[model samples]
Target: MSAYIAQACTIVHKLIDAGHHISDDDLLLAITAGLPHFYDPFLVSIDTLSDSEYTLELIIP
Candidate 1:
């Protein structure tokens, strides 16, 4: 997780340094939006356990 986050941050930094005009929030949002498609199925399953529970709790509570 840390490595993936670091890689994303590095990519964002590179894009910024190259004058690509991407804001930090925009990069973060794009990354998050694409995460389900990019993540490995096993990892997604593991992450889903917590995320789904939190989402359900938020909706019900």
Candidate 2:
């Protein structure tokens, strides 16, 4: 899980450094897409987050 989170962070950092404008919805989709199928339930739960409440904090620590 730590490796997966680290990889996701790296991808996000790279995307930002490359000057691409990624919206939170798109970012979350990308992250979830890369995760294993076992994480589907948790991802589905987060998909309902309001725009202002959406964040990557859950996987950061």
Candidate 3:
């Protein structure tokens, strides 16, 4: 999970460097969307947090 998150962050950073804009919420949503069904519980937990609390720093291990 940590590795996956790292890779996603790397890709996101590259996009940002290339001038693409992506909010942290959208980044997390995209990552969670691609995760397996087994991650549903974790996703549900994440969904309960306020938007301000959602960030790559919190999501990545």
Top lDDT hit: 3
Number of backbone-clashing residue pairs for each candidate, in the order shown? 0, 0, 0
**Candidate 3: tens digits of C-alpha lDDT, residues 1-61:** 7788788888999999999998887788779999999988998999898877877788875
TM-score of 1: 0.47
Q: Which of 2 and 3 is the better model by lDDT?
A: 3
Report lDDT (Cα) of residue 28, candidate 2: 64
lDDT of 2 by residue, 1-61 (tens): 7787667668878998999877666766677788888988987887787866676565343
Which regions of candidate 3 are displaced past 4 Å? none
Model 2 poorest ten-residue lDDT run: 52-61
Error of 1 at 39 (Å): 9.5
* Decreasing lDDT order of the candidates: 3, 2, 1
Give candidate 1 regions above 4 Å deviation: 36-61
Q: Is candidate 1 or candidate 3 better by lDDT?
A: 3
Q: List lDDT for all candidates, in order.
A: 0.57, 0.73, 0.85
Task: Superpose all Cα atoms of candidate 3 onto the true structure and report the RMSD in Å to 1 decimal.
Answer: 1.6
lDDT measured at residue 32 in model 1 versus the true structure, 0 to 100: 55
Pairs of residues at least 3 apart in sequence or in different chains that clash in candidate 1:
none
Give the winner by TM-score. Answer: 3
CA lDDT of 56 in candidate 3?
Answer: 74
